[model samples]
Target: MNWILLIIAGLFEVGFATCLGKAKENSGNNAIMWYLGFLFCLTISMVLLVKVSKELPIGTAYAVWTGIGAVGSVVVGIFVFKEPATFWRVFFLSTLILSIVGLKFVSK
Candidate 1:
């Protein structure tokens, strides 16, 4: 259950990050709505992350949470936001994913 919460928290991290990016691209009323939504999601994600950390080791929780968030956000940035999709960039992202998986399995 705690792992599930952690995954949800990681998803929220991606949501808030994408919202902030959209908010930055636009202006006026929509921007405000996006910013507020980002803040709300970010807060909720943090709270859930904290709860997960209590059950898992701090290092494990933080590493997995941040790794997923970072990788997920970058993927969204590439596909949704139309950022660069260079081979090197994809290679790095794959490396990060592998490292995160390794950590999840190897850590006690």
Candidate 2:
């Protein structure tokens, strides 16, 4: 259950990152809306992180959370934002995903 929450938190981290990216591409009201979304997602992500950290090791939780966010943001960049999906970029992303899964297994 806690791990599930942690994953959701990581997803919200991606939400905030995506919101910031969108904000950068807009102006006025649209930018403001994106910023608001950023704030909302950031708040939820932090709250869940704090909650899960109490049960899981801080180091493992943080690393997994960050890994998920990094991997998710990169995928979003490639798909939604149309960023380049170079060979090295994809290679590292696969490694990050493996590391995240490894952490989950090794962690208590």
Candidate 3:
């Protein structure tokens, strides 16, 4: 359950990052809306992180959290934002995915 919350929290971290990107790409009311989304997602992500950290080891949880966010944001950057998906970029992301999975297995 805690792990699930942590994953959700990590996803919200992606949400905030996406919102920031969208905000940067817009202006006027549209930018304001994206900024509001960023704040909302950031709040929820932090709350869930705090809740899950109580049950999980802090170091493991934090690493996993950031790992998920990094991986997700990169994927979003490639897909949604049309960022380049170079070979080395994908290779590193694969490693990051493996490490996140490994952490889940090694933890708790």
Candidate 4:
């Protein structure tokens, strides 16, 4: 299903983003591996998202894809990268999630 592909793409988005951050932090051979892996995943995910977008409304597809990726990456950044997890940051993240859900329903 297109929606399934969309979700997978979102997951890949998170994967690529996390990998990119890791690549930035490391040096030497490990950094190269992470960078290349990130690029590969990002490219594949974008292609899949484009395919799904052909059959779905652009607004809906893009919103869901980006929303999932943004939220997922931020969570990973906080837990894995030990980025700040302030109360306001969490509140804004929740708002983003709610907006995505609202958009999904309204678009449907």
How does model 3 fare in lDDT?
0.98
Candidate 2, residues 1-108: lDDT per residue as tens digits? Answer: 999999999999999999999999999999999999999999999999999999999999999999999999999999999999999999999999999999999998
Candidate 4 on 1-108: residue-level lDDT in tens?
888898899999999999999999999999999999999989988998999999989989999999989999999999999999999999999999998788767864
> Where does model 1 exceed 4 Å of error?
none
| Alpha carbon deviation, residue 12, candidate 4 (Å) | 0.7
Q: Return the TM-score for each candidate structure.
A: 0.94, 0.99, 0.99, 0.93
Which whole-number lDDT from 0 to 100 does residue 38 have in model 2? 100
Q: Write the per-residue lDDT of candidate 3 for residues 22-105, one digit (tens) a residue.
A: 999999999999999999999999999999999999999999999999999999999999999999999999999999999999
Worst 10 residues of 3 by lDDT: 58-67
Local distance difference test scores for all models: 0.91, 0.98, 0.98, 0.93
List clashing residue pairs in candidate 2. Answer: none
Backbone Cα, N, C clashes tallied per candidate: 0, 0, 0, 0
Question: Cα deviation of 23 in candidate 4 (Å)?
Answer: 0.3
Q: Please provide, for model 1 over 75-108, each residue's C-alpha lDDT reduced to its tens digit, 9 standing for 90 to 100.
A: 9999999999999999999998998889878866
- In candidate 2, where is summed lDDT lowest over 10 consecutive residues? 99-108
